[model samples]
Target: MRISRRLRPRSLRTRLVLIATVLATSAVLVCQAAGLTVMRSWLTDQIDERLTDFRPPSPVYRDVADGNGLDHRARTDDVLPSDYRVFFYGANGRLLSESLGRSDGEPRLPHTAAALKLWNGRPTTVPAETGDGSWRVVADSGSDGMRAVVALPLDTVEGATSKLLWFSLAIGTVVAAAVMVLGSVAVRLGLRPLNRVEDTARRITHGELALSVTETSPDTEVGRLGIAFNTMLDQLRAALHRKDAFERRLRRFMADAGHELRTPLTSIQGFSELLLQQPAMAPLQRNEAHELIARNADRMSRLVDDLLMLAQIGDTPAIRRELVDLLSLAADGVTATALRHPDRDIRLVPLADEDTTPGELDVVEALGDPHQLAQVIGNLLANACTHTPSDTRIEVRVGTVRTGPRAGGTDRAGRTSAAGPMTPGIPASVIEVADDGPGLAADDAHQVFERFYRACHTGAVEAQPGSGLGLAIASTIAEAHGGRLELDTGTGEGCTFRLLVPETTAPKGHTR
Candidate 1:
């Protein structure tokens, strides 16, 4: 088995060439054998026909009957070839007189009754009278009561057949060699594309990830193979790019998280050390230090909680799904924000296309985790309230917008269409939290949903700095529920955050 495997052709081109050569050689050999057989048969038949047609003169027969032997100078000798022989036999099947062909000595003759019977009246092959070679002979009884045998030597026929056999073998050898050589060349040309594929693979192994197969015709086997290879390469490159981006984002997130945690830890450590060293300090100063430490601790705790929540949302699809009313969630967020910042004008407003007033807005319902959606609304409201001045007016609007395949046109608030809905043409619920405040800069706007990203306001002072994870957590939760959190904002024009989720479609005559 090992030897056979080692002897087998390893390359595709070599195997193809070898197979073609073998088939051609086989065909040539079969033709050679067939030609040899037919030629030998035809030559032997001609020799038999000549022996049967030839007849000796009367003198030769008469002399042979009288035991005078054959007449060498008979006129019939000129009509017959020198290789023909005549033998005279008695009635008792005893050889009496004979004529030798060109060969010396007496030729082998069939003298016995059984031999004469077998060779009578038809040509048959038998050993020569000289016991040297074979002859084609016929036996017959003459009218003079004498029996005669005529024979022909087979040397000429065999000699011609031998020459033809040798010629055919020579021709077959040349044909096989030409087939091998030409077949090898044809196979090499046919496999050129495969050779290119091999070279491309070698280069890719050496780290050329951007390379793609260019012979994508789809008309031949090799062309189709090239097309598949190109597709696989494209997908591989895309996956690698995504992996690289994810790694970079993770590294940045780690660094920012460490920095955020370190700040609060440092403040807590400093305040505890102060209390330890100054036990007799003034009550007011000590109380202020305690308050500062508590505030920092609370910020650190909230940051940790937000980080945990983001991780959960990113790593799993285990959100508690239920039908959620976006209008009610927005109203609740407005009430909570108003209590937190009573100086700010925070209200729930109707969208431009809503037929009813703000207080009677439609129940914009969707399928999602209620707690997570509520958190998203609360975070958007809190983000607006924290970033802008106390006099800024914040508006929360809720409505259903067309989404999904064939979804087009603007929403009620004159915004571009979102993605298609859960059920083909059904609309998706959207909650927009808009604030007329000092909006984020163009650069900061893009990275607002990134972990630990905080925008700086130039002309306003915040009542308290946040942990910078509210928007990030909100985005993560929205994605986990198969929804998206999009922001529409510009410098000085204020900011608006849109939360769009797939709406639940109920059966006709039923409400969800």
Candidate 2:
């Protein structure tokens, strides 16, 4: 719920920005301090040097030589302002001469007896006031008892320093603020890739695997992370697809298996009902009930056998490049179906495409497992029959069906097709079992392959019959052999199931 929270906690941009801000602020502080220290020290050194270097004439002679305040003895005025106190002191406790400009009652120099005494013996610094409100005084010993005394103002110098300090502080503050702002921007920019990755990852969860691959690369660590994440998404998508298929098949298998087993149970119940209804009836009535029960039992047994065969076929491998005989598979399927459902018509016609026997005897051939193919055809036929009333037409015709037109994968012979089409250029070696029975519901086209998905609304079943897994099993088998099972929704009246098997150019081989 916290929208302001960071998506990438340890982001590169944030770290770099923080580091830059710290260094920038530190540099500003150091430079400002150094500048202020150097300026203050240099000013202090000049003032002290001036105090030490000044030499004055004798008090009487200095006053007489300069002619009151206009003399060159006031040369210190040219260097500093007249507001400062410039005077001469004797080591013999004599106040030689003083240039007291604008001092009415008392001189700006500290002329108190205690200060003068200290000033005479020791060249000292003291509190003094000149034309300005107040200043500090420095008196230095000179040779021949002519000491120089200079009064420097605390107020003026401090005012200048205070202004300088303020400016420096302002500049430093601005610099620090700028550093922080720029750091934040740079952090966002640098972490932009990570944001992209986050967004792409979010999209991938919504079934957009193609959204994230370009966000990061495998070159840098971040790129590597991106690649790994994308790969994981791909694997997850595949897994989910397989899981859905599995659930669908599982449900169909359970439904069909359960439905197929119902006959025996119903027959058992029916026989029990009859026996109860006619306990003292004729012996013929009992015999007829027994016969009906046996017939139902036989039907149930065959259904179980078919279910088991289909399940077994699903488990077997159907290699794409392996050889198989279409004729033999079709013949066997036809014979089994004819025997199993004697009341219904089942036929298999090996309709060769070219019609002429090329390279001896031209028979339908392809790459597949014979057992799975048998199951595929048998299940298709059985499905057609199950949906139709008895005596409905059901035929499976196999031949060299064409597959092309759409471009696709590279074959060893350099042939390609498009769209990964099952029925590509021409009619693929297809076997279609269609009937005039109640066709598929428009909605059931997609769901017929789903497990246990009986069309309860259609009223097709006396009860839910036929494990829905049959078509699913057949479809899987077909795909394993580079073939596909397609349902032709021929209106809602009937659905035609087509098995498109890829026929190879391999020479005709003898079938045992």
Candidate 3:
């Protein structure tokens, strides 16, 4: 086991080459063994046939011999080859005459009458009593009470078989070598792409995030693996980028929050210090200082509240979801804004073909946190009123719009919006707060929904003071409700803020 483990290939290419070599060698060996067996059998049969061709002369020729008994040596001249041996016996099982072949070593033939009779003249293999080797022998009895045996040695067959075996070994060795070399080349070429992938991984490990696998063919296993590996790398890179961006945003948000809070805190502290240091000041002066302090404190409180609302909206399950009447929400927002800024002409534009009668509740509905939705609408209206002039006309249009099949749209900045398209043929509730006022510049409009983003130009004479978090809060709330707040504005072209949310139906047996 230890030896085998040590011998096992460590590399894939080596293993593949070794396997191919082993298979090729085994096949060659099997063929060689089978062929050797067949050839050996054929050679042995040829020797046996030659042994059977020996026809001994009858004993009648022995009486006319020059009294040399049976002239057994003459039998080799006509029918027997130099390698054949002949043995003779009398009817009484007595040894008579024996004749040796031309070969130097003498053959061990059957000496007893019973042994000779057992042969029955059929060709067969028998071990030589001389301990030299084996032979193919035939024995038979003649009509004149004479018994004769013929034999031949098997040295030629064995010599030829040995040479053939050596040849087969040489052939098998060459074939195995060829297979190993070619198989190694093929395996190396096949694994080149994987090597590149490994190199890519190494580079990536060292912080090269942009590197990707180049072999992306879908037809081969290696190609498919490369493609999947590239996909995973892409996802990893994207996730890392998102993490970095989030960290940047978080740092900016922290800085902005600290700056926003510091202004009000400083004002409050300065005013309180003034009042405490000058207790003898006039009543009117004292009252004004107290009011300034209270106003800054209130501003700080509102900022904190907006921050908390953003945090809550970020938590997916924290927002309550219920049926909401968008048109009513828009109408209420318009009414409230008009009261706040009577100079600005604010009005809610009803959906086309819809009744505008007083107390009419039928309108486009959506599923969301009604309170949050109301806050979103109120924020939009307040933003419009704050940014626009007194004479600017603010129109709140509430209705349902048909959406496309594929759900996705980019914001003004080409960033993915908080909401995607609704189901095909389905309608989404929309509220557009459009104002004929000084609109924002293109650059400012892109980041208008960002936290603490204050536009310097409203196309109006002057931009109003704001915490700059209202629209950000509104956008977050819209996202929590699976909706989006979109802005369309240009310099001097007026500004339009559209709120789109998926439409929903009320539960059965439920009434608004």
Candidate 4:
């Protein structure tokens, strides 16, 4: 086993060639063996027929038989060639006459009683041995009770078989070698694509992801493999890019969080030191310092809480899903905002008749964590109230979207329309918070939902009290419930924050 393993070909091409050669050679050898067997059998059959015909003295043999002495007839060399020998044996197993007399004066047929009885006037072929070689002999007896035997040498058949064997071996060897060489070449060509794949892999391992295998056909094995490999590479590259982006976001978040926290911490520390050092300070000064410390501490605490919430949302948030009435939720958000800013005009427009009544709104439900969804609405309202002037008009529109945006529909001048029929899927609930205030610039509109991103302002209302995470958290919460938060804003026009959440038919107690 060890020796066979050692002799086995290592390369696929070599192994394929070896296998082809072995199978071809085996087939050739089997055919040659069968052919040789058939040829030898045919030749022996011809020799047997000749021997049987000679038993009843042919014309040549009869002519020789007319001679007076048996010796004279046997010695008629013209009648029989050297390859043919004839002999006569008496009933007592003694040699009577001989043609082509023995070299050492010994009888060609072995003297045995069984042999003499077997040859009693019956024609049969048998094998006999002489000093020279083996022979096939047919023996019979004439009316005079003398056994006549005709023999033919086996050398002719053996010589022909030997030549055929050598010729087959030579031809088979040449064919097998040719097959090996040609098979190796074919195998190499077939596996060339795999070699290219290996090279591509090596390049990818070295960080060269742009290289790809050229796929010529999708039906062939190598082509399919190339296509699959390229797809895998594409996925790998995309995953790596996502990883890099996530890391960058993480780093920037840490830096921004640290900076935001440091300000309140500095204020708290300074005010506390001031209060401690001035024991005889006035009551008003002491009260002012205490208030400042408490306010800054509260600010820091809110920042920390928001940071923790963001982290928790980054992981899979434990969302308790249940049926939620989006209109009722929007009404609650608007009520809360009105109480906080009573001077602002906040309008609640019911885009659908179902949103006009509380009972109807209850029927139009969405599946989500109600608390998170409410927080998203509350955050949008708070962002609008904080960014706009005290008298700016804020509108909260609630409706059910039976279909999504049409293929070529436009949203111009704050108006939207559908060009196609409603899609056959779950309906979505949309809530838009639009405010006529100092709207976001084009650049700020895109980065509004990014963590720690803030817009630039240049007036007295520029100082916005925010950690820049409210919109980001709202967007995250919206996505967690399989929804999205979108924004539309233009300079001096207004800003509209649209939140679309897919409505569900789950029972009131459904949880996920």
Measured against the true structure, the TM-scores of the candidates, in listed sequence, are: 0.81, 0.48, 0.79, 0.81
lDDT of each: 0.75, 0.61, 0.74, 0.71
lDDT of 4: 0.71
TM-score of 1: 0.81
lDDT of 2 by residue, 195-294 (tens): 8888877887787655646755666766887888878878987898999988986786676667667757888798989899879978998998888788
**Global fold similarity of model 2 (TM-score):** 0.48
- Report the C-alpha displacement of residue 367, candidate 4, in angstroms: 2.6
TM-score of candidate 4 versus the correct structure, residues matched by position? 0.81
- Could you say which candidate leads in lDDT? 1
Q: Stretches of candidate 1 above 4 Å error?
A: 51-81, 85-151, 179-193, 354-359, 404-426, 458-461, 507-512
Q: Tens digit of lDDT per residue, candidate 4, span 3-119?
A: 999987798778888888999989998999899999988987877777666643443334334444455555455555545676755455566443543322222465653554454
lDDT of 3: 0.74
TM-score-wise, the better of 1 and 3 is: 1
Lowest lDDT 10-residue stretch of candidate 4: 414-423
Best-to-worst order by lDDT is 1, 3, 4, 2
* Model 3 segments more than 4 A misplaced: 1-7, 51-78, 85-133, 136-151, 178-197, 219-222, 269-290, 353-362, 404-425, 459-464, 506-512
